[model samples]
Target: MGSEIAVRVNGTLPAFSDFGSDNERAGEVESNPAMKVNTSCSLIIHENGKPTKHILVDTGNGVCNSVKQACNDLLAGRCVIDAILLTHSHPDRIDDLSLIVKEFDNVHVYCTQNCWNDVIKKFPDLQSIQHTSVEAGKTFEIDSVRITPVSVQHSNDALGSVAYVIESEGRKIIFGWDVLTFQNPNDPLLKGADLFFIDTFTYNPHPETNHLSVLQAYDLLKIWNPKEAFFINYSGFADFKNAENPYARVPKKPMTSDELAAQVMSDTIPWGYGWNERVKVASHGMVWRSTKQIEFMSPQFSEDMVKLFTEQNYVFSIKKGKKALEVTAETDIKNISYEFIKYDVESEGRRIAATTKGGFLAKPLQMLLEIDDSSDPAIVKIKVGGGTNIKMIDQDVSYQKDIHVKRVHADRLRDFLMKLTS
Candidate 1:
């Protein structure tokens, strides 16, 4: 059975100071300084829902609470901490290990010899917990998961930080946090990963700290070429609110194509988005299942399917047309949080239509999906809106039916339609 990874928490310590102050920019303080508990991630690995292997990568302050909740929510049981894996002895990463172990029994803690000693020094009570020393380039098995520790440079060399390559069955994940620089670019552990969770403490091109910057992560992704990647450990100065956009922040000054390419490589502006199509910023309670087992079906005319889309707080519908499937939805176009372009609008139209016989103006967002039984992928064109604002003379406009275009992935809609209409 293949292992599935789920994020229990998602965050890192403040890059600047404990106060989370950043005079450098405005509106950047939303990066979890007040809520450090949301920054650190605790992951649970499971297979077949029988033997769940709970491997915690880090235990930042207040993460134990998040993990406990996640276990109950995801596994449908109480927290079962099978093992605790430490990337380093940084206080932010290992502060809550003692508290977490208190809630469980027979928990094994894995880390480097130096890190283990430091952990013991910091949390003397953790001495009772079983310890397994790991060395760089050596593989260790904790339950069914095989992990290879690879040393990486961080601010504090005394603790001796190391990254990990966790493999189960044929799937593999590279977890590298608190990373400043890699010892070897071609390290065997750094190659061939299904998913990579790395550090992104700063968003600047030239970061003063030893931690990895967003731009640096882009370069690493180009070299490693993982199937998917996620940026963790964001700082206050990093772009937090506008992470959904193609570009986190557009450069104020213009430069040559070569210079522009050097800075931003990804299509989306956020640290994770533009570097690779699959890469995204890791968040709390994010669950990833390797294979789609088709657990449930969304048949046509099912109210459950509409409820699923309605729960998103957006207006949308899936209609089974004779020739094809039709999907219509609307989202507020005023929100600039997401900056993206999809397939350069093949053709668009906008006209004021009648909402009723009284002639109230109404605008609508529409997309058409053509089903192709052939091997080739279908050309699905989706329009969030007609790229125009809805204008009605009446301010109250009670009769006007609102239609602000909502962008939906055509492929996903197509797949659901195939299953529902099948």
Candidate 2:
């Protein structure tokens, strides 16, 4: 994507954000990844560096506080939603459909014809909403983002079930959670993806839901070879504390997020081709940003120009404990959207980031990608290299005092009239 496309892990399970609700949140369950209804929601921000399109895949538990906050962020604080792609008709998946529609009245919902009947009947408040009955093969568009619905094998509990392969700003992402397998796994649209958010409910098949096991998700990752993948909707209860699981690989206990990450890394290391960097166990507030060439930048660099947006800063992490924030940075630089281009050296009218304190680069870096903020700018306190220790220029620099006029997502209201005549 020009600016970038970003995904926010709003929720991961059907449980509330507290303990006891899911069997019991005591003991190991405390770290077993609290369930909050899984969904792969994201924003597609284009050249302006402001999100004009937001996509929600599988509205799990309807709209919780975190999910509501995400919708607000993507809509620029406006009570609106661009579109919602329903993955299946499970009650947990579409429980709050009416609430979402009631809040954002104009929000368009995309689901199967059966899903429409399922939701409308269950949630009568959505009777007047605008809904599109999506087909398996037909591709639809909401602004510049194009989405193709694909059939997936799940329980017959719902009238129908489907997955989505989304095409946004030159990136193809597949969001197919709560599925055993795709009806057409080899569909052309599923190939050569930039990112994938797939169901990894349990390591072993469960008796309740028809979702993919962790191994199955790994197999698909090997076949598709997406630039990156996120495993979501993990079941903390599906452990073998006293029971003999069907598989040898199924953990004796449910793997914590850290344990899952370590196992995923270990498993993919044998597969080679750097699959370790490609797959991850996604949790609430996890984010993935797309990287591309800065073709639109002017000839505004010195030979000694340092790079600001490098692969080192590609996978930015949100700190634990606090809520994760993924919002757009609207700026008019060589593009990598400027969080704040202070202490800059101007090269042919374009500003390059000069470090007030120390930096990985010695200024004069190419600004080829859009500047993006992975979290609340207030707490986004990182120097250079995005919290990674890499090669740096030893300038021995420090800031006397610093102030900022930044394009931050969580800071303030978006000024629609950028070029306002005072």
Q: What TM-scores do the predictions have?
A: 0.64, 0.65
| Regions more than 4 Å wrong, model 1 | 1-19, 22-35, 236-276, 292-422
1-422, model 1: which lDDT tens digit per residue?
A: 55555544434443335323433322333443444463455556656654376777778776777676666666568468777888888777777788888877788888999999999988888887789999988898876779899888887654578888888767788888788888886875687688788876666543445678766887887788787777766553433434556655553232221222233334434645334345555543455544531111121245224311221123445444444333344332211111121111111211211111121354332222232323322222222332222233233321112222122333344444445434
Residue-by-residue lDDT tens digits, candidate 2, 52-111: 666767665634555666555544664456788888777778776766666655778889
TM-score attained by model 2: 0.65
Measured on C-alpha atoms, candidate 2 has an lDDT of 0.57
Clashing pairs in 2: 13-36, 13-37, 62-96, 305-364, 306-365, 336-369, 336-370, 336-371, 337-370, 337-371
Model 1 Cα displacement at 346 (Å)?
A: 30
TM value for model 1: 0.64
